[model samples]
Target: MPSAPSVRSPLLDRFGRVHTDLRLSLTDRCNLRCAYCMPAEGLDWLPRTELLTDDEVVRLVRIGTMRLGITEVRLTGGEPLLRRGLPGLVARLSALTPAPELSLTTNGIGLARCATALREAGLSRLNVSLDTLRPERFAEITRRDRLADVLEGLRAARAAGLAPVKVNAVPVRGVNDDEIPDLVAFAVEHGYRMRFIESMPLDAQGAWDRDRMVTAEEILDRIGERFALTPIGREGNAPAEEWWIEGTDSVVGVIASVTRPFCGTCDRVRITADGQLRNCLFATEESDLRGLLRGGADDAAIEAAWRASMAGKGPGHAIDSAGFRRPARPMSAIGG
Candidate 1:
């Protein structure tokens, strides 16, 4: 077992970036098989015994918030809603001292049923993945005919008062690219903030191609044709470049991870469901926190290990570089 450092500090990389946001994956088991994320047949899910218990999760998060300087916690997953006792987990994380702001990103399959429970349990925000407006197109992209369920989930999230319900849409060039305008319109109509993300290279099949991605410029142009867009610029460490939809008070955002990488100001770090810490989303390397957590390591030791992992973070994901390589784990396994 490693001993704790004499002095502790915030999670900082060598490049001078301070990580305050934690994307904690509840489970790697998702209900949907989105083409960009998972295979149609689904994945070989992690064994139940391998996953961090609810108690283990709370302990790590406590260490992150009380010891380190984590101010925000985003619950993510293959689908967070699939995690049993989610409301209880959120309540526990919310009760932390210093109390990190809590949010969740989910496929929205079962959100309609539990959005209120989650909100009452202290979840403050939500981001639901809805790739297209058309049911057939949605089925085509996700390989599941559950568009109605997702839409209802969004509505339920709104009803539960999870304000500014953000909708995340990934516009694949030949697939849902044409629905960009409609997607934005739907968001605006329903008082949801729409976010368009470029298709990344994290696809399980390793079939991502730059040419096949609908660039940010193209996405803005598509929305521009119908709605007037005024730039709202970007806020601190946020991955999205937002814009006001001119007439309405609502805003739309685009996460151009490929065309416009924001690694320089990144303050986010991720922990996969099975307890591996990833300094970067596109990282090919990971540090095992599970071993330490289960092997009787002290809290200070865990914090020290976390700091060491971030120390090795590179300048960026380097997707545009010719030498760039996709991570061994797909988006589903790694946590979106």
Candidate 2:
């Protein structure tokens, strides 16, 4: 006879966004080749067998939702859409106890094809990473000529009733920095919020020129001329400086990870597709939870492991102030 499994109680952050908001990376695979993110050359991706099965992920999330007050879940990937049957997984994760709010972050290339199914399956919201709206520039930035596809996907997501969708613009100084105002305008017209994130040192394998970095404060200053920007409050779990323009319907957020560090309010945790628990995105160390999961550890065992990982989290990363060099892991390695 099989033994009964152990259970973990609900978890919460200091900011109260339920520490259960799991960033479940489905695969370390992506199709786009953005200069700021994935490498131009092909990467050595992990084998398929090494990935967590869809069922396994759903089960883990379900347990978290039931015991640990997990009310929100965001599915990310090297490109989440690359993983087939993703909507099925979304449906599964959406049906969890009290039910988690299901959302996803995608480059939007494959989203047009999957948006309808995703909406039907219980996806509540979406955040698309769109740096440029120009066709040629889109190809130049992402190393892929799929701007049309991404735009179509955005339309589909909106039509599917995934309201309040977000667009993330990672401005890398001279690269897509000019697109900031364009993105803000687009967000205003479409009723979606756009977040401008300062480039960080997550791209380990590639050369990360911190000198080419553009801080969130700079982005806000540039756009302040067109729209009157006012500070907005968050639940405190999010690290972005939120501002809303009075006349426009859109909201702008600045993720000043490099300039204004918010690690003190860092309460989120990341779980790789293979189950390695990462305390901080910029931290070099991570704890192994895959072994424990595969060994049939009970819920209490899993909860204890989560607590231990949380305890090990550093106060914050010093790459910005300490003049530290970039780490070895790429941005893709750190999910969306």
> Which candidate has the highest lDDT of all?
1
**TM-scores of all candidate predictions against the true structure:** 0.97, 0.92
Clash number for candidate 1: 0
The CA lDDT of each predicted structure is 0.91, 0.77
> Which residue pairs show collisions in model 2?
6-299, 9-67, 9-68, 10-67, 10-68
Sequence-dependent TM-score of model 2: 0.92
Please list the residue runs of candidate 2 whose C-alpha ends up more than 4 Å from where it truly belongs after superposition. 1-18, 321-327
Give the per-residue lDDT digits (tens) of candidate 1, residues 23-83: 9998989988888777789989999899889988998898888778889999998888999
Candidate with maximal TM-score: 1
In candidate 2, what residue range of length 10 has the lowest lDDT sum? 1-10
Clashing pairs in 1: none
Please list the Cα RMSD from the true structure of every candidate, rounded to 1 decimal place. 1.9, 2.5
